[model samples]
Structure formats: C-alpha cells, structure tokens
Target: MLYRKKRYRINDYVFIGDNCHIGNNAFISSSVKIWNNKRIENNDKITQCNL
Candidate 1:
C-alpha cells in the first residue's frame, strides 16, 4: 500500500486490499472496499467497492 500524500480521509468499514495506491486528498466513504492492484487518483471520492 502506498499513499501519495498525508491528507486523506477514510470512513468506517473501509477495506483496502494489497498493492493499492491512494493519492492526495482522497476520500473513501463507509463500507467501501478497494480491491488489489488498484490506483485511486488525487482528490478521489469512493463510495462503493471496485471489483
């Protein structure tokens, strides 16, 4: 797992798999799961799982 910046917010029940990259100002909502080898860009807002 790699984080591009320190500024980010991850809500409750968030699952981030292996080899995932979360960029700056990223916001992950509740119950959102990010699968493996995924890349979330800067200022991203994730509200659901990425399969």
Candidate 2:
C-alpha cells in the first residue's frame, strides 16, 4: 500500500488490500473494502466498495 501524504482520511472498519495506492485528500468511509491492485485517485470519496 502506498499513501501520498497525511492528508488522507480512512474511517473505521476500512479494509484496503495490497498494492493499493491512496492518493492525497482521499476519504474512505466505514466498512469500505478496497480490493487488491486498486487505485484511489486524488480527492476521492469512497463510501462503499466499487467492486
């Protein structure tokens, strides 16, 4: 997993798999599971699983 800056926010129960790239200003809500090889762009707001 690669995180750009400390400006990202990951809430409770957030599961991010391997090889994931969390960009700057990204927000991941609760109970959100991101699979492997996923790319979360800058300023992304993920409230749920997109897969």
Candidate 3:
C-alpha cells in the first residue's frame, strides 16, 4: 500500500508546496513562503523565507 500524507493551507498568501510537513498546533504568520519538502514543527512561527 502506498502512503499518502495529509495536506493543509496556511492562509491566502502563504504557500505550502508538496511534501511540506507542518506539525500540529503550529503557528505560521502571514506572507510565509515555504519551499517544497519543508518541515515545520509544532509551536513554530514562520514570517518569511530566505530562499
């Protein structure tokens, strides 16, 4: 059996690419541009992306 992961959108301007892992109860601020395969653990606040 293939393993399918669950996905979710942060907000209107925030973009979460494929394979992005956002832990439970994670807090992401506005305008955060997270690239592909990024893992954000719980209680994390993302405001911007350097890449």
Q: What is the C-alpha local distance difference test score of each model? A: 0.87, 0.87, 0.69
Clashes of each: 0, 0, 0
Q: Candidate 2: lDDT of 21?
A: 93
If both were scored by TM-score, which would come out higher, candidate 1 or candidate 3? 1
Task: Put down candidate 3 lDDT per residue, 1-51, tens digits, no spaces.
Answer: 997554433666677788988976666766777788889987666767532
* Cα deviation of 28, candidate 2, in Å: 0.3
**Any idea what lDDT model 2 has?**
0.87
Backbone clash pairs for candidate 2 read none
Query: In model 3, which runs have C-alpha deviations exceeding 4 angstroms?
Result: 1-9
> Candidate 1, residues 1-48: lDDT per residue as tens digits?
985447889998999999999888989998888999999998999887
How many residue-pair clashes does candidate 1 contain? 0
